[model samples]
Target: MISRGIQSNKVNGTFYPTSFILVGIPGLEGAYKWVGAIVCLCYVLALLGNMILVTVISASSGLHKPMFIFLSMLASNDALLSTSIAPQMLLVFWFQKRYIHFESCILQMFFLYSFTSFESGLLFGMSFDRYFAICQPLRYGSIMTNTIIVKLVIFLLLRAVTLFSPCIIFIRRFPAFRSNIVNHSYCEHMTIVKLAAADIRISSALGVAEAFMILGVDLLFILVSYCAIFHAVFSLPSKDARLKTFNTCIPHMCVFLSFHGLAFFTCLSHRYGGKRIPPFVHIILADTYLLVPPMLNPIIYGVKTKLIREKVWKALHKCQSPHVK
Candidate 1:
């Protein structure tokens, strides 16, 4: 039979070890399959949920306000995030055609990074929104105006693109080797760079640096923002008002923990000494970052965000209702 599979890129002599390759395969196979299913599910829900969010928040006159603008932005960002990885991931897992065109791979990496960064940025934005609503309720309206929201959205898009652009440029320009197979299910930066036949020390270094850059730095910002928010919540005079404010943020906060924690620990582990850790552990942590977050976001957001549940119920009811004459 003709060779029925895509050729994978591999490390050449004196580079990474073959043992490294063997370790991740079985573990990755199972993990990717499970994660892949969840990702597919998330893509469906995210599509439905976010579209409804955009529609409901847009069509409803009461929701046509500053807070809803950011909510819509969150929905749109989640949609972009799922689009970045879910479909391609499901395909890579279900089929044996594991190869991606080099250019296409570059494009995918660009987006994967972009959307993920956008997510991180969006979470930070959400926290900021909560901060304004609770801490500076008097100024929330003026601060989160349409013009300001537009500016924030534009800034977020630009930041995500810029943060991830370097990886694409570096990889595409780097001299590639005969081995081109990427071991992971998705086009991830560190995993892809590992396939580089040429000297990739700089890329690897940046890869490590980027991990800390997001976690140590971005996470710090998130924590500080939340601290301020908590302080404001406690200082409020009415216990009922405090409870209501906290309730409003429970969904966003839950999604934030699931995604940010996984992304941070996984990437940090890989960046530090993952090469020494058994490839199975590496595979689970490394690849899971891409797969798990996309899958988890929908469930966490869908369940936690009351509006998502209501919209889903509305759609279901509408479906079950008989057609009118």
Candidate 2:
């Protein structure tokens, strides 16, 4: 089951949100709101931050180029990622009931997968952007245009949808089980897949294949992008310019590593050493990967893009300016 209509699927074999403690904490009511609150806040921030990015891209005449267009797409994925998980998580946490219908759970799973895949692809795209800028400075302007960016966005969307279609096929194989307990607040893909009463060899294979495909391809592309970037940086005329480029990349790389890298770590831990790991530890790491990055993305971009701060002050000054007589 996915994430969509879990509340509606409370009865029958569809899916239900039963009252249960979240995975991170000991029990349901005593101390989970803190986690829920943080998650919800991140979602809110992501939504607003993305909107601001979209607005800035739209408003600024100077920013109406290919790079900002791609940034807008990445922001869109970030918004989707936050929206898919945060609202339901907040509702369940506050009300003490976390029943989710099977169909709804499946829908949610689809979105979660789709947005994340799209994000990874977008990061790969950004790496390409940087590569072109650094490596082929003269050609960068011609290579990235509005038409090309739009086409790339469409391609990424279609690819994400196509790649995740197998997840649905695999999910349908599970027979209805009596127990409806979901170890997590929102039906995480791995959490539900682990509970399948039926043989999930196919699903397992698909999951692994998807993981490797997305992670492997994206990493390869990113590596190529950075390799080109390194060449350019090394060939730069000044040491200060090289330092500047690396400094610009540091935050994005940290965020990139933290999000996908943590997922890779958790998958490995579960595969070879999960038996020894405590549930709380598992939950904390999983939640960290989910909740932390959305909050940080805006901060990273805002700091990296000085224009955002300048625009903010400019707007504030305009707002405080004296009214016309």
Candidate 3:
């Protein structure tokens, strides 16, 4: 398979593999079925949970507020992110179809990273919404108008595309690859770049720069926003008022920590824990970073946000007692 792919792309003078082999969980070949089953479950839960959130938020007029609107955007991004990685992963795990076309690999990398950037931007926007709602309650509505929200969403989409499009060019410029086998599950940027025979320092540096640009900047803003929010919460006149206000920020905080925590840990493991961490462990962490947040975000918001909780309960009740009309 590898020889054929290399030969086909060696037309004319240049060399590029037509397809790459995906070694899913390097040493866990015997347990591919079990792993695939678990992955399939997570994918389903992610899709189902995110889709439900989007549907409920869209169907109800009460959820037309800025907070819920940002949440629906987050849900949609989660669904897209999971869809980009999980199906290809399942194909490799279940059917032993481990070969991915070069073009498909590049497309997968684009969507995966782009949606990740979208999630980061959405979380940052949600933090901004919380900041105004708590610290500047009087101006919250005016500041977070529908027009502003629409503009913010557009900016995030454009920013992600404009920033990450360079990755495609970087990958395309590789003259040849050291090997046609990718050690990880999906077509991750670093994993694919590492396969190139040429010096990967530029690609690696760009990946690091992009990470700091997107994740680091967004995290700093979110932390600053929360600090200001907490200060305002504590200054409230009554304990109940402080508690009530702080509760509103809980769901966002949980989601922020989960997404960024897994992301940072996975990235660190990949970069620094090469000797200490097993290859499969790195793969698992990467999968968790992609899978856990999407599976957990809707649940966190559904339970912590009062309106969403009430709406979900009402939905379940209607389903259970269909004849009650």
Query: In order, what lDDT does every prediction score?
Result: 0.66, 0.71, 0.87
Q: Which candidate is the best by TM-score?
A: 3
Residue pairs with backbone atoms closer than 3 Å in model 3 (clashes):
none
What is the per-residue lDDT of model 3 for residues 137-158, given as tens digits with 9 covering 90 to 100? 8999889999999999999999
Between candidates 1 and 3, which one is better according to TM-score?
3
Report the lDDT tens digits of candidate 1 across residue range 216-290: 566677777788888888888999988876876665666677777778766666567656777566656655565
Considering only N, C-alpha and C atoms within 3 Å, which residue pairs clash in candidate 1? 8-181, 9-179, 9-180, 9-181
lDDT of candidate 2 over 211-264, digit per residue (tens): 778866887788777877877788888999989898877777787778778767
The stretch of ten residues in a row with the least summed lDDT in candidate 1 is 14-23
TM-score of each: 0.81, 0.87, 0.93
Top of the candidates by lDDT: 3
After TM-score superposition, the amount by which residue 65's alpha carbon in candidate 2 deviates from its true location, in angstroms, is: 1.4
* lDDT ranking, high to low: 3, 2, 1
At residue 66, candidate 2 shows an lDDT of 65
Per-residue lDDT, model 3, residue 298, is 89
